[model samples]
Target: MKQLFISIFFLMNFVCCFAQEINDKEIDSLYKEDQFYAGVTYNLLGKMPKDVSQSGFSLGFHLGFIKDMPINKNRNIAIGLGLGYSANSFNQNLLINKDNTGSTIYSVLKDSNTFTKNKFSSHLIELPIEFRWRTSTATDYNFWRIYMGFKLGYVFAHTTKYRGDLGKLRFSNIEDFNNFQYGITLSAGYNTWNIFLYYALNPIFSGDASLDGNKIDMNAVKIGLMFYIL
Candidate 1:
């Protein structure tokens, strides 16, 4: 599965690169004219996808506004700011942790028939700053752009629920899930309306590792649609 993700990253990059080569000059002219825009996007996040290969899918919606300032016109370097909301979760068997002191930690891992079915959901506020380049313009109103950016997110709301043979436990205020995830987002699509995909490089959990090595993988890939709302 990891290899599959790597392949996708490379493929998207290849397509973007080739397209840029063909229309780099044309795109450069228009990008300077459009420095700020606002849009709405609907995203589907697939979390712990390594485990939930068949049934793991989470949905998210984003209403964001971005402003761009040029650093270089030839390379298409710019700074951007954006805010969005996202939520995702999954269910599977796990082994929880319990401490002799302090609050007991639970590990609903990949193994253990103790059967730890859990759900993790979050409401996020994000600020992303990126550098983007554009290529391939069918016209001044429509073109393709490729951007690589970094996003920092704060968890405004987070919850983790566990259910096992022993019944149920809910941890709604703990900081088990890593509140910070830093990664590069590669986006490619048209200017009027585009399809954006993202991959997070960091794990979402920030505690001790359990038997399955905290098998609750935080790496996620999301697909979203972007368009002008204003």
Candidate 2:
């Protein structure tokens, strides 16, 4: 993690210097038209069950194209619509299982399991809409931006995997997993580096999904960096 932070810091500096080296004419041609959006985030599970805990790093990535429409004369403010594919993995200790009746259940694995890895992963096709504000001119390549948006996603796949004393096992197409998800997102920063956050408004699983007899109400929370390319 320390090395990751160091690399990011230097990368941002390099971008700043590179942007400065470019002339206004070139910068204008590059940034005047909004192009693609791509980003990665560190996932954090919020309001998780008391017995469940994260065991390692969780991460997510998105790739998409953005269509930006200027809402102001200066084009500094605009609204954007993006279509994207996103995937996420949550590395944790929770054991996802199915009872004899085939109901999905979430439980904690015993320490004796000596697990090497345990995780849940999902992929989605998503549409994101954003209201964007930026301190940018047609001739400027480096600028500050604030983007707030909401995203709707449909799950295409879901899986769980565990490698431990009992041996490696995987469960695909988990039952009762939510097929649709919606969330609010915010990204704010300067130049190529932006702070990104996402909060899911819906549970990860259907309301009827449970652990033992209790409802599973976990939602995903993600925070990290976002980078945009034009």
Candidate 3:
């Protein structure tokens, strides 16, 4: 009985040691690429109304984490899935206000002198999926990367503010603004600094808002620099 107990203890310890050795080997051999990223963008409105244009500075900020899954043996080619947050503000001449009956109104500002500031901002939660290709190695931290992907976002908070000669008008969570936004993204560069572009596939607003019976079809185009950390 004593001999059997000693044998069992020795076997358990050996098994544990083997398992630990395997774990260490797996970890040491594993190479993971860019799992975190942050970016800044200059926001622009595309396909604008006839007289609608941008003013001031339109900027966007984005940050996220991606799960890098290597598909090839070299690990340079991978697919990334991530969740991120984006805050974008578009400063433009489009004036959004409310009527006396509490209905929303949209119009273009012809005279810049009439208004102090008129702009709209939206904050969203975004999901990003990318096909990643890079010149990266296990020991090399500096490499060139070109990543293209699709991003789907949900606008959780939004606001439109107008401060002008007619006092200040501010609206929260405008119904006309589309809550669901999706776009295509591209990023390419070497090392940490990368050029990024996001072109929205859909309009930012619903078709209910119009100018002189013409549908106000507008989308967003953002181009900026992105930084990634492993």
Alpha-carbon lDDT, every model: 0.53, 0.80, 0.85
Error of model 3, residue 51, in angstroms: 0.8
- Comparing 1 with 2 on TM-score, the higher-scoring candidate is 2
Worst 10 residues of 2 by lDDT: 24-33
lDDT score, residue 16, model 3? 46
TM-score of 1: 0.60
Full candidate order by lDDT, most accurate first: 3, 2, 1
TM-score of every candidate: 0.60, 0.86, 0.87
Residue-by-residue lDDT tens digits, candidate 1, 49-108 = 343332233444444556766666453555666666555443343323446665535543
Shift in Å, residue 189, candidate 2: 0.6
lDDT of 3 at 97: 87
The RMSD (Cα, Å) of candidate 2 is 3.5
List where candidate 1 sits over 4 angstroms from the true fold: 1-56, 72-77, 91-104, 107-117, 135-139, 162-168, 212-217, 228-230
Q: Write the candidate numbers in order of decreasing TM-score.
A: 3, 2, 1
Candidate maximizing TM-score = 3
Candidate 3's C-alpha runs over 4 A off are 1-28
lDDT of 3 by residue, 60-165 (tens): 8788899999999889999999999999999999988889998888888899999989999999999999999999887676799999999999999999989898
- Rate residue 214 of model 2 by lDDT: 81
